[model samples]
Target: METFLSNLSLGFSVALGLQNLGLAFLGCLVGTLIGVLPGVGPVATIAMLLPITFSLDPTGSLIMLAGIYYGAQYGGSTTAILVNIPGEATSVVTAIDGHEMAKKGRAGAALAVAALGSFFAGSVATLVIAALGAPLTRVALMFGATEYFSLMIMGLVLAVVLAGGSVLKAVAMILVGILLSTVGTDLETGDERMTFGLIFLSDGIDFAVLAMGIFGVAEIMRNLAQPESRDVVRKPIGRLLPNREELRQSWAPVLRGTLMGSILGILPGNGAVLAPFASYAMEKKLAKDPSRFGKGAIEGVAGPESANNAGAQTSFIPLLTLGIPGNAVMALMVGAMTIQGIIPGPQVMTGNPSLFWGMIASMWVGNLMLLVINLPMVGLWVRLLKVPYRLMFPAILAFCCIGIYSINSLPTDVMLIGLFGLVGYLLIKCGFEPAPLLLGFVLGKLMEENMRRALILSRGSLSTFITEPISAGLLIVSAVLLVAAIIPNVRKGRDEMFVE
Candidate 1:
C-alpha cells in the first residue's frame, strides 16, 4: 500500500508537470480529430507523428502517444453514433445500436452516453493498471513459450466467437489471414515462402496497409457505390443528456463492461480488441428484451463504448510491463520506446519509476480531456455527418493513401492498399466478415513463433503445450469452445441468442 501510494504520488507529479500536461492535451486533440475521420486510425496517426517524438523527452512523448490511443477510443464512438461508420474495429459494435439511435432522433443522447461511459471505464481501468500493473508483470514473466502458444490458441477460438454470423465463415477468414501472415520470409530459416519474386512481399504486408485497405478504402468503395440518400442520416439531433430511466438502465452495463474490458485487456495477442464484442454479447444475453439489440438499444451503445475505452487503456499493460506488443498499435509503441532509448519490461518500472507511473497517470488525465473535448464538440461531429458522401469519401481516400504511403515512403504500399481494397469489397459482397481476418492476421505470426519456440524447447514434443498447467487449462477451454460451436444444438442455441 505504501509503495502504491508513493508511486502514484510520483506519477501525479510528473503527469501534472506543465510540459507533459500540454503534450497530453495536444495528443488528445489530434487523436480525437483523426478518430472522427474514418480510416485514419491511431496506428497511422502515431506512426506519422513518431518522428516528432524524437525531439521531446521520452516520458513526455510516451505520455502524448498514450493520450492519443485512449482519445481515439472516445472519438471513435462519436463517428459511430453520428454517421453509422465505425472509425476503428473497437467501435464497430458501437455502430449497431448507435446508428439506430441516431435514426430514432437520439443521436445526441447516444453520443453523450458513449462519452460518459467511456470516461467512467477509463477512470476505473487506469486504477486497475496502477494497482495491479507490477504484480501482473510478475505473473506475465512466469509465462513460457508453451503457455503463450496455448494462450494464442484460446485467443483465436474467441475470435471465431466474435463473428455475428456463420462461425464457419469466420474460421475460413481466420485461416486465410494466417495464410497471408505466412507470406513473408521464414524468420528462422530466412527463406522466402510466398514472395514470388516481389521484394515487397519479403517483409510481409504491413498491418496499417492491410487495415487501411480493408476498413478504410473498402468502406470508401462501398459508400461510393451506395446512393447519397442512403448514406446520410436525416433525423433531428435529440437531447444530449439521457433521461433518468435511460441513465438508470445504462449504469449497470457500463460497470459490467468496465470490469470485462479491464480483465481482458491484460492478456497477450490483442485481447483488448475482443472486449467490445464480448460486452455486446453479454449485454444482449442479459437484456430483458434481447430483440431490441441493433435497433437503438442504449445498453448496446453504453456497454461497448465503455468496454472499448477500457480495453484501449489497459492494452498498454503488456507493452509497459513485459516488452510484448499485444496488437499492432502497441507494436508501434514498442518501436517508439526503442527509439527513445527506453527498454520495455519489468526494469522500466524499477529503473524509471516516474516515466512508468506518469504514463499510467496520464491515461486518467487523457480520458478527462476527451470528455471535455467530445461533449461540447458532439455538435461539430454531427455536422460532419451532414457532409455529402461524395465529398467525405474522397477525403477519406486521400487521407488513407497519405497515411499508407507515409509508412515507408513506398508507392508499393499504396498499390497494395488498392489491391486489398478490391479484395475487401469482394469479401463483403460474398457475405464474409473482415474483423475475424484481422484478428487472425494479428495473432498468426505470434502463434507461429511461440509454437516453434515451444517445440524447440521440448525437443519437438507437441505434448509440452498440454503438459504445462496454465497452457493445458487454456487449451482445454479452447477445445470445449470449439466443440460447443460445432455441436448442432449448441450452435442453434447460440444463434438464437444473437437474433435481433
Candidate 2:
C-alpha cells in the first residue's frame, strides 16, 4: 500500500507539471471537438494524429493520446444526446434515453450527467489501475496460444451477444474482418494469400484505413442517404447539471458501471466493447422503472457512458503491463510505444516506471481536463447541431479522404476505403455490426503470431493446444459458448437484435 501510494504520488507529480497539463488539455480539446462531430471517432482521429506523437516526449505524447481516447468517450455522449446518432458504439444505450431526453428538452441535463458520470468513473478506474496493474499482469502472462485463441474465440461469441444484431450476421462480419486481416503475406509461407498481385496489398489493410472506411465514411454515407426530419434542435435546453433526485438515481448506476468496467477491461479480446452493454443491461434490470429506459431514463445515459470511459481507461492496464492490447486503440498505443523502442511486458514498470505511472496519473488529468473543457462548451456543442447537414457532409467527406490518403499516400487506400465502405454499409443493411469485425481484424495479426510460435515450440503437435490446463479450459469455455449461442432460446434472442 505504501509503495503504491508513493508511486501514485510520483505519477501525479509528473502529470501535474505544466507541460504535461497543457498537452493533456490540448488532447482533450481536440478529442472533444472531433468526438462531437458526427461521423468522427477517436480511433480515426488518433491515427490521423499519430505522427505528431512521434516528435513528442514519450510521457507527454502518451498522456495526450490517452486523453484523446477517454476524452472522446466523454465527447461522444454530447452528440448522442443532442442528436439521435451515437458517436461511440458504447453510447448506444445513452442514445436510447439521452436523445429522448433531448427531444423532451432535457438535453442539457443528459449531457451533464454523461460528463459527470464519465469523470467519476475515470477517477475511480485510475485508482483501480494503481491497485491492480501488477496483479493483472501476472495473471495475463500465464496464458499460451491455445488459451489466447480460446479467449479470443469466447470474445467473438460474446461479441455477437454485444453486437446487438443477428448472431449469424455478427459471425459473418467477424469472418469478413478475419478475411481482411489475412490479405497480407502469409506468415508461415513466404507467399501472399489474397493480395491479388498488387504491391500495396502485400502489407494488408491498415487499421486507420479500415476504421475510417467503415465507421467514418460509411457513417457519412448512411447519414446522407437518409433525409433528415424532426430537427432535434427543436427541443429547449434544460439545466446544465442534474438535480438532487437525479443525482440519487444516478449514483447506483455509476458504481455498478465502474465495477463492471474494471472487471471487463482486464479480459483480453473485445471485452471492453462488451462492458457498456453489460452495464446497460444491469442498469435496466436493476432500475425501478424499466419502461423508462427507452423513453429517456437518466440511468441509461449515466451507466453506459460511465462504463465505456472506465472500460477505455482500464483497458490500458493490460496493454501497458502485458503487451496485450485489450482493444484497437490500445493496440495502436502499443504500436506507438514500440516505434519509440519501448517493449511492453513485465519489464515496462521496472524499466520505465515514469512512463507507466505517469500514464496512470495522466489519465486522471485527462479526465479532469475533459470535464473542464466539455462542461462550459456544452452549449457550443449543442449549437453545433444547428450546422446544416449539407455543409457538414462535404466537410466529413473531405476529412475522410484526407485522413485515409495521409496513411500511405496511396490512392489505393482511398479505393480500399470505398470498397470497405460499401462492404460496411452492406453489413449494416444485413443486420451485422462492424465493431466486432474490427475486433477480429485487430486481434488476427497477433493471434497468428502466437499460434505459429506455439506450434513451432511443440514441433507441430496439434495436441499442444489442449494439453495445458489453462489452454484446455479456455477451449472448453469457447466450445460451450459456441454451442450455447446456437441453442434455440439464444438464437431467438439473437434474431431479435436485428435492429442494431
Candidate 3:
C-alpha cells in the first residue's frame, strides 16, 4: 500500500505538470471531436496524429494519445444518443436505448448519465490500473489461444441476450455477421473466401462504413419515409441534468459496469469491445422489467456507457505491463513508444518509473477533462434535435459519406455505405435487431484467428478446447448462459400457446 501510494503520488506530480496537462487537454479535445463524427474512429485519428508527436517527450506523447483513446469513449455516445449513429464500436449498444431516450425528450438526461457514468468508470479503472496492474498483467498472460477462443464463444452466446424479441432472429443475425466476417482473404493461405472477385472487398468491409450505413443512413430513410414520426424528437427538452431518481437508478449499474469492464479489459485481443455488450446483457437480465430495454431504459445507457469507458481505460494494462497491444490503437501506442526509444513491458517500470507512472496518472486527469468538456456541451447537442429533419439529414448523410471516404480514400466504401443502408432498412422492416449482428461482426474475425491458432497448436485436435483448463471452464459457462437465454424464450412460447 505504501509503495503504491508513493508511485501514485509520483504519477500525479508528473501528470500535473503544465506541459503534460496542456497536451492531455489538447488530446481529449481533439479526440472528442473526432469521436462525435461518425466513422472517424480513434484508430484513424491516432494514426494520423502520431507523426506530430515525434518531437514531444515519451511521457507527454503517450499521455496525449491515451487521452484521445478514453476521451473518445466519452464523446462516442453523442452521436449514438442524439442521432442513433454510434461514433465508436463501443457506443453501438449505447445507441439502442440512448436514441430511444432522445426521441422521448430525455436526450439531456441520457447524455448526462453517459458522461457521468463514463467519468466514474474511468476514475475507478484508473485506480485499478495503478493498484493491480502487475497481478492483472499476469492474469492476462494466462490467456492462450484455446482460452481466448472459448471466451469468444462465451461472448457470442451472450450476444443472444441483446435481442428484446425473437431469439431466432438474433441468432440468425449473428450467423450473418460471422459469415460476413469471413469475406476477407484468409490470413494463412491468402485465399479469398467470399470476396466475389471484388478488389474492394478483398480488404474486407470497413466497420465504420457498415455502422454508418446501417444506422445513420437507414435511420434517415426511416425518418424521411415517416415524416410525422420526426416530430417526436422535437418534444420539450426536460431537465438538462439527471433528476435525483435518475441518479439513484444509475449508481448500481455504473458500479457493476466498472467492475466488469475493469476485469474484461485486462484480457488480450481487445476484450474491451465485449465490455459494453456484457454490461447491457447483465443490466437487461437484472432489470425489474426487461421489456423496458431497447425502448428506452436509463439503466441500459448508464451501464453500457460505464462499461465502455472503463474498458477503454483498463485496456492499457496489457500494453503497459506485458508489452502487448490489445487493439489497433494500442498497436499505434507501441509504435509511439518504440519511436521514443522506450521498449514496452516489465522493464519499463524499472527503467522509466516517471514515464510509466505519469502515463497512468494522466488517465485520471484526462477523464476529468473529458467530463468538463462533455457535460457543458450536452445542451448544444440536444439543441440539434430542434433542426428540421429535411435540413439535418442531408448534412448527416454527407458527413457519413465524407467520413467513410476519408477512412481509405475509397469511393467504393462510400458506395458500400449506401448498399448497407438499404440492407439496414430491409432488416428494420423485417423486425431484425442490428446490434447482435454488429457485435458478431466485430468478434468474428478475432474468434477465427484464435480458433485456428489453437487448432494448429494442438495439431488439429478438436479436444484441445476441452482439455485446456481455462478453455474448458469458459465453454462450460457458455453452455450455461446459452441454456439460460434459451429457456426463457421457450417458456414464453409455451405460455403464449396455452393462452391462445
lDDT of 3 by residue, 91-191 (tens): 99999999899889898899899999999999999998898765655565677888878866775675565345677887898799778878878879999
Cα deviation of 453 in candidate 1 (Å)?
2.9
lDDT of 3 at 293: 97
The list of candidate 2 runs beyond 4 A from truth reads 17-19, 47-62, 83-85, 95-109, 144-157, 186-189, 233-245, 264-301, 322-352, 489-500
- TM-score per prediction, in order, is 0.75, 0.83, 0.62
Best-performing candidate as measured by TM-score: 2
Ranking under lDDT, best-scoring first?
Answer: 1, 3, 2
The prediction achieving the highest lDDT against the true structure is 1
Winner on TM-score between 1 and 2 is: 2
Tell me the deviation in Å of residue 163 in model 1. Answer: 3.1
The true-versus-predicted C-alpha distance at residue 490 of model 3, in Å, is 0.8
Model 1, position 200, has a per-residue lDDT of 88
lDDT of each: 0.81, 0.77, 0.80
lDDT of 1 at 184: 84
Which is the better candidate, 2 or 3, if ranked by TM-score? 2
Return the lDDT, model 2, position 377.
79
- The parts of candidate 3 lying over 4 Å away from their true place are 1-121, 129-133, 222-363, 374-385
